[model samples]
Target: MPHPQAKIHRMFELVEPIATVTFSEVVNEAFLSLGMRNYWDGYFAGRAAPLGLAPAEVVHAVFYNFADGEVARHIPWVWGKVTPQEALAVRERASAVALRQQIGEVAESPGLVRVADLATRAAMSAPTEGRALYAGLKALDVPEDPVAKLWHAATLLREYRGDGHNAALVAHGIGGTEAHVLMALALGMQAETFGRIHHLPKAQLAAVVDGLRERGLVDAAGEFTDAGRETKQRIEALTDELAAPAYDVLIADELDELIAGLEPIAASISND
Candidate 1:
């Protein structure tokens, strides 16, 4: 059976282009960091149906506010200072930059991959898979940032064995970081790459390793402990169970229709 959450996530994917484009607009206008925008956009978009915001409204808010001077100050130019034409031009340029950056970030961030994989698994699992994944996440006893909490859960579930390394590495590269850096060390990246990709120094990576070790999640050599391995497995299993239902619902016919509808915009964005 496909997991409820997995189905839900795939359903969400049907709307990802809309959400992602909205997010790009918001981040570019508000001057919010790429990380912060990704975190909020994912959380909000995922929960939008339950939370009562039209997905388009969420995107609108970011741009409107940025133009109105209501948020972050790092955007290239203040919204009010620019003419309407200039704003449009800037938004277009920024949108292009944001998409490429996001792809790169997704390629590099191990925590991101871990979360995505588990989410994929949870979606494949059962109706109860999302709840179970959330419960496991709660048990981690981490900080309150939802994004960070999600990352911790992903870290706990990641399959760090040698065979899994290549897929993990590819995900990191897409996000624009070294695979070993994010997965093994549980640290933010440091090296600066296209978009917002940053590469971490060796010492900083070691510090992350130490932090994971201190939490009993890993050993001195940065390998996951027995407890970590077990937890990760459980989460992955639950995600897998959640995804089953979604896989079935996402039948070939429906997917074909969705692709037909989405292809134009998706292709335009990619080409831009």
Candidate 2:
């Protein structure tokens, strides 16, 4: 049999994009209506909304991978213009609308209800200590509608896993810029692409890449060395292991049912 964490990881991967629906055009327009025309403004504000006017430093600390000033550029200021509660409302509503549009009839089917129940069980059972963002999201009320409930559950699970992943990176001694560079290499993208995503300057990005090469993590061409690949795998496996505890509430049959319900919906949304 696969490792015990394997199915839990599979379920998490399958439903991940349910939260990505928050980034769809529908959600963008909703943010526009609230005067958050910039995507980053919406992103930081919306995700951080459940935390209730958190400072930039707090967001930066919890988010753990943004370039130094990137979170500051959007937070505090975004809260000044739009309250966290308002942003939360817009995010939940727009995300539901976007997910509904993408997933169609499946959004209302009984199968989705089953997925929501099982996923919510896992989310609610997840550990809260040291997981700031997950704790914030967990504080919210579970939606009554099946589609919204599933989306909320998926988001909770995503943030839970994200919090664990951050801990894994920290434990592995990977800094934010270094982490982005490593992910860029792993994803087969230019290091600059990740730097751009995190808003790191070219010089800073180059420095990180050079440092990685010096550490024998990446070769001169900015690709992973054997040690780098093994390190990445170790970090990911640890992340998966940390995240697995949340799903412990589900019995074997329920896990099977949950995964079955999620797979088709996830496939539909992905292909859409």
Cα lDDT, all candidates: 0.36, 0.86
lDDT of 1 by residue, 197-271 (tens): 223455654564566467665666556678655544454344344333434545455444433443443444445
- For every model shown, the clashing-pair count is 43, 0
Query: Lowest summed lDDT over 10 consecutive residues: which window, candidate 2?
Result: 193-202
Candidate of highest lDDT: 2
Runs of candidate 2 with Cα error greater than 4 angstroms are 1-3, 195-199
Tens-place lDDT per residue, model 2, 71-169, is: 888988887779998998889999999999989998778877888899899889988998999999999999998888888999999999999999999
- Could you tell me every candidate's TM-score relative to the true structure? 0.30, 0.96
What is the lDDT for 34 in model 2?
84
Lowest-lDDT window of 10 residues in candidate 1? Answer: 154-163
Q: Which predicted model would earn the best TM-score?
A: 2
